[model samples]
Target: MRIISFQLPVVLSDLDGNRKRFLKAMAEHADDKDVIFMLPEMWGCGFDYKNLQNFAEHTYELISEIQSIINSDTLVITTHPETNQNKVFNTVYAVTKTAVIGKYRKNFLFSPTGEDNYFDKGDDICVVDFKGVRVGFLLCYEIRFPEMFRLTASAGADVVAIPAVWPEAKKDHWQTLTKARAVENQMYVIGCNCSVMHTKKKDMDCGYSVAYDPWGSNLYESVSGEHVLTCEINRENVNDIRQKIPSLSDAMKVFEIKRR
Candidate 1:
């Protein structure tokens, strides 16, 4: 699968501006088939907690517009604020030109930023089969949790997409954890993050949108600013690595034995 990750600068609460920029950037690749395009977490609005509900109202509209632009086989993954009743969740959606295939609401809210106070967590694991490849999801803060990645791997994921707004201060963690997940699971991992956020107080994100192959090798890595990084990954490579290492299966067997 061809993975294209966009490291965009989020305009904080400016939903219209962010929407226009994202759509314009995606328009060029609208016809690109057999590809997965990844955008940063909360691309439409950067954790604009005060007005998140207002932003959530426009989430479907943005998805509709995105669906209208991309090809039928092009899969786009991104996260945004979603509202259901009185609760709001940080939802990641997997979409194609035809329909929304799957969604994973972020379960582990970042308590450092009081994310748990604002958003309700999701319990389901999102693993979707697109074309011939199995795709999985892991939102920003979720990268710190290895069990989530293991669950996706167990569910037969060939590649995992991580949409993040990771801080510049934790750049090393962002890079290390992404690679760890890929190597540990023997699956492709693509992480897309923001360059900077334009809010009342400008916040700089790590912005090192990167991809790692099953062998823990870097497929693509972006610079500190806004940029688009693309790389082609093969599911056969994942299979080869897992077959050679066999750690994933070994660990699963060990867990099964311990359960008895």
Candidate 2:
């Protein structure tokens, strides 16, 4: 399957602008099938917490528009502000042309940025099957939590997509964690991060979109810039790596930890 990550600039609170850029990118790859396209976290509005409700109001419209542009076999993954019961959540959506195949809200909020205050956390861990591939999700801050990823791996996830707005300051952490997730989980890890934002914040959105195979090999890595990174992966690799290492299967399903 072909996995593509859309790394582009996000203008804070500019729903229309971000939507246009997202659609333009989607249009370019509209005809492709058996492909998964991942977008940066909150691609619609970049943490415009003050106007989050307004952004949430347009979430459905933006999704519908994207649905119209993609092919039936194409699956698009991204996070946006979604309102439920008057509470806004950072929701991850896996959408096909016909319907929304999978959905998961951000479980781990970034408290450093006060994300916990603005967004309601989700309780479920989502792992959905798309064209025979078990695709899992991890929003920005959630990547730091290995337990969540281990759960996804144990649940039979072949690929995990991380949508983030990671900063340039911690680029090394981004690189290390992304590879580690793929290595430990024995699955493909695709990270799609936003590039140069139109914000006053110095260099927050450092777009280094990347993909790694189950063997922790870099399939494709983009420099610090706005560019769509694509890599073709074979599902067989996951099986092969698991058979070779047998780490996932050898792991103890249940264990007791006592203070030493």
Candidate 3:
């Protein structure tokens, strides 16, 4: 399976600007044959921890207009309108050929800043068959939680799609954790991160976006203020790595859960 990741600069909570950035990335990788595209967290709108009701409602129209422009055979990942129980979710949408195939909502909000205060948590994970490959979805902060990937692997995921708007301060953690998850789970990790500075938030973004093999080796990656990191994921290699390492089987041994 071919994977395309976009490390776009945040448009500073401007949906119109952010969607334009996505069009740019799409133009760059549109010719790549059979590739599934991914964008950073809140791709439609940048992180809006405060006044989410105002923020979420504001972007729907812009998103609908942009959604009309997406061409066929290109799978794009981003967030849009999702109606929950008397509420709307900042939910991620996976689209292809003018159809929204699936979605994954942000579950692990940054509790420190009370992001949980704004967005309601999703009750379930999204694991689906991406054409012929078994794939799973994970949001930004969800990368730090191994349990998400564990469930993905257990559910027979060959590739784990991670879309994040991670901060620059945690660059090490972002890179390290992605590799670790791929290595331990014996599944492909496709990480797409934001690259621009956020106006409301003081910190910058970790713009490095890439795809890692099951062996934990980064096959292709990009470091820039903003970029479209597109590369073909050789699905054949996935089986070979798991066969050689056998970590998935090793995980079947035993473990304990500790509630922090």
Per residue, candidate 2 scores C-alpha lDDT tens digits across 1-260 of 89988889988887889989989998999999899999999989889888899988888888899999998889999788999898999999999888888898888999998999999988878889998999999887787988888877877799999999988778888988889999988999889998866665654658777798999998885588878888998889999999999877777445431211
lDDT of 3 by residue, 1-260 (tens): 57777777776667668777787767766665566778777776665555456666655564455456555656766665455666756687777655667778767877885767667877667776666777788887788899878877876778888888777777788888999999888878988887875676465757877578888788665575766666667667778887887777667556532222
Ranked by TM-score, the better of candidates 2 and 3 is 2
Pairs that collide, model 1? none
Candidate 1 lDDT, 125-239, residue by residue in tens? 8799998899999898889999889988988899999998888888889889989999999999899988887778756656888899998888885578888788998999988
lDDT of 1: 0.87
Off by over 4 Å in 3: 54-67, 201-203, 253-260
True-structure RMSD for candidate 1 = 2.0
Global Cα RMSD, each model: 2.0, 2.8, 3.1
Query: In each prediction, how many residue pairs overlap at the backbone (N, C-alpha, C within less than 3 A)?
Result: 0, 0, 0
Judging by lDDT against the true structure, name the best candidate.
1
All candidates' TM-scores? 0.96, 0.95, 0.87
Q: What is the lDDT of candidate 2?
A: 0.86
lDDT of 3: 0.72
